[model samples]
Target: MQQGSLARYKLYPSSLLWLDSLSQAGKDLRARCCQIQACDTDMVKGLAADAHRLLARGDASGGAIVLICLADRCRDAGELVLAREYCEEAVSHFSCYDDCRHAHNLAVTYYALGLVYQSLGLETDAIGSYDRALEAFDEARSQWMWAHECAKRMMNECDEVVRWIRELRQGLALGQPAPPLLTGTLVKIPMWSTSAGSLLRVREEPVDWVDVEVSALGLANFALLINGNSMVGLGVQNGDVVLVQETADWPADGQIVVVRMDRMESESVLKRFYRRQDHICLEPANERYPFLIVLPNWRLKEEVSRRYAQSHPERGLEFFLESSVHCVGWYCGKVG
Candidate 1:
């Protein structure tokens, strides 16, 4: 296709969304679909010809598989625009079907699409594509994973691919400097946290949950990811995963713990817990940062309110500090 002619199909501006294809789900399916297995230039050219023939013959599934294989290669070779074009055409023919094979194909296509966006530095869009991939993989795994011989052979790899996507999505959310690839041998743990001061609901899935390898300290009930240098004094560095043991009781003097203050149930923060004769302190690990000290009375809140009243009167009436500090969990140790 010529450059001027390419602009006619306007779905892709700066050339996005052309990728579509299937993973090597089963040997039988590929054999049945023109046998264009490898990504070599000659092979891909032949595959393109076969893809057209298959589509002309009304074999939508086979055609999509070939297009996606081509897309996958284009992605690998840094031909992102071409990759998306192949994927888009693949999408035009097939998205999903009741059959498990179609679902597997859809999953692979979505994964490839995610890679395109990820390489383009579009983290949010890449995450969305991976989400779609997970959905398709879920459907495929439920009934087809072990049923067909070819599908069975590909199950483990499919699962690992999904896990890898999850890892990528999460690391991006946390702004991880480097995301480690954990082998299958390690136990995966569900995390309930927010880095620094954000909110993540416990009921929902991980776009937040992180995994860690169990150490001599034993397995933590939950985990949190350190996102900033604020916790450096506590030996928790950026990108480190902090394992926490869930506990109702507040930490004894000088112990580190996770806590939610002022009725912010969804948002949790980590601090050094200490108790005094009259007040309790949720001390920040770094002294340079502000300390969260619960004063003996409403003096702290009153002083701030008095200053604010000179400018805004309405908010002063509405503002009330609720010091209901709820302990979330005890910090176990750091794991990266």
Candidate 2:
């Protein structure tokens, strides 16, 4: 947490440890946590007792800090389940306190939870937690950065990257790009297709089709205005239109594809597809966004949903969540 240029000084001024740095404060807590780490079942009971005592004392802020530390201690000690429970409770307790007072600590608390989730193999949840931590840290930095800028009369952003972001990316494989694969085909001839066939399935379908050229693709291709910055790492900026070729085929490793996850009504996500041994991995180019792991059945989803909706006219529009990843097409290239 202390790796950043600004974080070294602004971590805990007067709130948790007064003038003491995190390392200085951890000495006593670490000693006791080391003792708690030895016992198997008793560790859980001991920490629970410690948390209860801390909370019951009416110092909610202090209790939250202690809980966060205890949660980290549990994480380091290989007690994954206990780490998750305690860190979550710490977040719950700390949430009542004003954001101005404990934003940085709350960010750390969320990071600790992300670590626990990563340990348990919940990759998506881990990334989601990290995203939350980043948001909290951003909030925490505003006041400190503002005060420092005011003192110096400088109008500039702090250039240092936060420690948690770097640490999580390295740990979660978010920083590493997948290895390249050889493909014989430089370009495949796409079958002549049009937008007329695909538009029938969507409820709020687009009426006017733009003639954004996708090299040679026609009837089988579609366009989407990129909505989020999740793919900024790929030079895909927000509001830029992307051309996609219509296909339901599973993409080769590291191939970018447009797929709708969770529901048919949901907006499609542009991601790098990697098929793992167990689950499918759909990763975004940006670290700020969380990647997905799913086993979707898009065809089954369409069948069941359309049947249910058509069978019951009085129900208006109600569909089951039968899929998690519905492949819209493979990404052709960015148009705008």
Give lDDT: candidate 1, residue 253.
67
- Alpha-carbon lDDT of model 2: 0.51
Give lDDT per model, in order. 0.56, 0.51
Tens digits of per-residue lDDT, candidate 2, 99-128, equal 433666666677667767876778778788
Error of 1 at 49 (Å): 4.7
TM-score of each: 0.39, 0.39
Predicted structure 1, TM vs. truth: 0.39
Clashes of 1: 8
lDDT of 1: 0.56
Of candidate 1, the 10-residue stretch with the lowest lDDT total is 9-18
